[model samples]
Target: MHTFSRADFERFGQLYDIEFRFPAIHGDNSTDDYIVARGEITEHSLASGFRFTFSSLEVLEAYDSVSCGHAPLLVLVVLDGIVRLTLGSVEHELTPGTAVSMQLHPDYPLQAHQPEQQHLEIMALAFDPRRAKLGHVSPSLHGLTILPRMPLRQWKVPHALQQLLRTYAGLTMTGTQKNLVLEGVALQLAGLGLGSEEQESPDVPVVPVQQRQRLELVRQHLEFTPDHDHSLKDLAQMAAMSPSGLRAKFRAMYGVPVFDYLRKCRLQLAKHYLEQGFSVEQCANKVGYTHATNFSTAFRREFGFSPRQRTVDQKK
Candidate 1:
């Protein structure tokens, strides 16, 4: 494992305007194991805003960290342990098997509170739009300007993809081979996290302006009011389209099934409430779930963790 010292961490703090607090060591001379408890952090820089970091640290004591930077994009995957993070104005408790993606700015840096006595393994990829060329970027990101902030996106990481990331992080190869592997991994992560892709040869059909506007209206309703009991028939009527047409066209426009998107929004809201000290039952009611059991099942499927895992105690 790579070794780091207190001095090294201090330097890092200075560079990133980050503040880190942990248990102080007694002796003047301290070893890596004594300093980090266990595991290590491996970082690889690809470009101005493109960086990959794999961290597997056994935290010995509870610690807090806050950092501010101007990176445009960040993709984080939690392989183990819970990550309590507050990005800008929102807070989230990330458990194992969950992945989160966010657009970040210098104004609202990521604040993290890491609990001790458990091993934490995570992989993070940071990229800047101005510094790198991201071809065929997602439509939502096109003409992207640096905004004050943006909401985060969360999802469950597939088991296969999780293993692939772990393999790439632990590779011991050096030189050209290692660089090539890391670059590939970074691209794959960008595609999954940022919704970027390669240019397609087929030309996409032009959507009518009114039709597109109607679809957007439905989308905004789902995002802003996820607590409502939404059905395809009802949503289609709101959009002035038939149910089947709404289903096919909404997926074509947004790249996700309509109800699937609604479920994600509902669960995301539920997770936020859970972190804010709401009980699972309350969260279920707030998210339009009549049955807490059904809501819990969907929440687990969406985030890969039990709803109770995000309680305030677990958040610690």
Candidate 2:
């Protein structure tokens, strides 16, 4: 188990530009009482033109507390353990993988119940409704909107929200970059709450067996000679399918256009050579790029840094 001390919480809060406060408890308090593990208050601007906090609460016992009383809407995600939340008269049990959105009213109260030694990690995003202009968002997001006096629950986790959290917690992004990433996440969460579940299309035709076989053959061929300058028409002819048909089917199966995949393959080969200490010109030629300059441009776009810089960064 990972235990965070009070000093750890304080340092993290300072680094993230949030406030962390531990509530003072009276002597002889029971284990099952409302306690604040780390109180985070944030007002940082997001790239999407909003400001909010990424706060966590560690509940050691059963406790009731009112949160987001001043905010318009609050979003909660349970990262670990179980929590039973009572909003008004209704009760909701939130477990791992559960995302809930609740709108706050002045009189709304929340009660949290947990067993002894059981810990719950809760992340909250508090935002103002009037300033957020929730109603003005696209109609597709209407379902995600947590209206005042209403509580909403959804089953599946939003992909964008997950990505945002991953980036915020894992990546080394700073300043404008971090804000942009957070805004994107907020927008995605809003969209998921507002939009209807997208229906999968059943009418789209499946690729024929022969075409599928041909795509597999192409994949194998590329694996063998990834550095080759194979044109789309040539690949289509080899696959015995029209160029357009091959393009669409390849995208459907691989999630990237054929040419783009080829480019990635070439770049991967070049990166391997670079990591093995090959010079720019040698690596470029080995990866089918005629000029080192061209290889460098493509490499920077793909990896966000030059090959040499990557090697240097790795050394550090």
Candidate 3:
């Protein structure tokens, strides 16, 4: 077992990013801000790694597009702001109050976009399932319960779970205190994410290749027309799928229930509008919210802040 108190986040971001689409990252990652990505590794038997981080990169900027292909399964929780991720052909809008379990199982391409100059905070936990060759006589790899074996499953992170992650991220405790606290919290979070797997079972039939293609069409439609009036019947009719099948398969493939995904899209569009000088009312209308008050409440609940708090920030 090993503990790393201060870890380099941007450096690790490169371990995946630089290899794919990003050429370089530029921002003020001075000494103080540069090394807060922390983790603990227990490699005695099973090669297990857990990292819980709250990274705020001031003046953070990325040059070029993100083209991540085939990254392993991990639990990603967005605590603030929005992160747009394209996994395979299905694009997902990850906002606060949302969590997803996705695996980069060979050739599954992922492209992520967070508006430049918008600070984002997230907690990502990575664990390896492979066993170590020489450690504690090699046993108990399956005992690790936090690792997601099911691949691409997404669900909402409960408020209590969100609080736990935030507490761990902001902890001033160090040395053994940090390690003890982190391992417990990380495992707990993982277990919570795994609980979402009960939604899938032997009862639900697998989606066919052609229906999956139709679902892709539906995904593209939502992406392009985030504000359009969409109904489940209309969407299922368009996709040529039974309503029930469409609902189940959509959640299976995209990790979000249909209505939930729609809300994510609407709020994400609202984020763009608010950040672009639109008044709360105007933005609310643009995203199809009937009232500004309702929109504000939803936005606050989603991203941890009110729309009034965001300025029409131009890149400085």
Pick the lDDT winner.
Answer: 1
Q: What tens digits encode model 3's per-residue C-alpha lDDT throughout 1-316? A: 1222113433444654523222343355433243222234221112245544454442244422353533334677887767777554345678887887665433344566655445456776654544223453214334343223343467898898888776654468876677677666666666666664345666657767677667866765675576788999988998898898789888886678877777877887788776667888898998888888998898999999888887434322
How big is the positional error of residue 72 in model 2, measured in Å on the Cα after superposition? 3.7
Output the lDDT of residue 218, model 2: 72
By summed lDDT, the worst window of 10 consecutive residues in model 2 runs over: 141-150
Q: Which ten residues in a row have the lowest lDDT in candidate 3?
A: 37-46
Off-target runs (Cα >4 Å) in candidate 1 are 1-6, 23-36, 47-49, 129-150, 195-316
Q: What's the ranking of the predictions by lDDT, best on top? A: 1, 3, 2
The residue pairs that clash in candidate 1, if any, are none
Ranking by TM-score: 1, 3, 2
Q: After superposition, how far is residue 33 of candidate 1 from its true place, in Å?
A: 12
Task: Report the candidate with higher lDDT, 2 versus 3.
Answer: 3
For residues 213-249, what per-residue lDDT tens digits would candidate 1 score against the true structure? Answer: 6887687668667888888899999899999999877
lDDT on C-alpha atoms for all candidate structures = 0.73, 0.59, 0.61
TM-score of every model? 0.56, 0.43, 0.46
Cα lDDT tens digits, model 2, 171-237, are: 6777877766666667666544433533424654666656765785675456447788898888998
Task: Tell me model 2's lDDT, rounded to 2 decimals.
Answer: 0.59
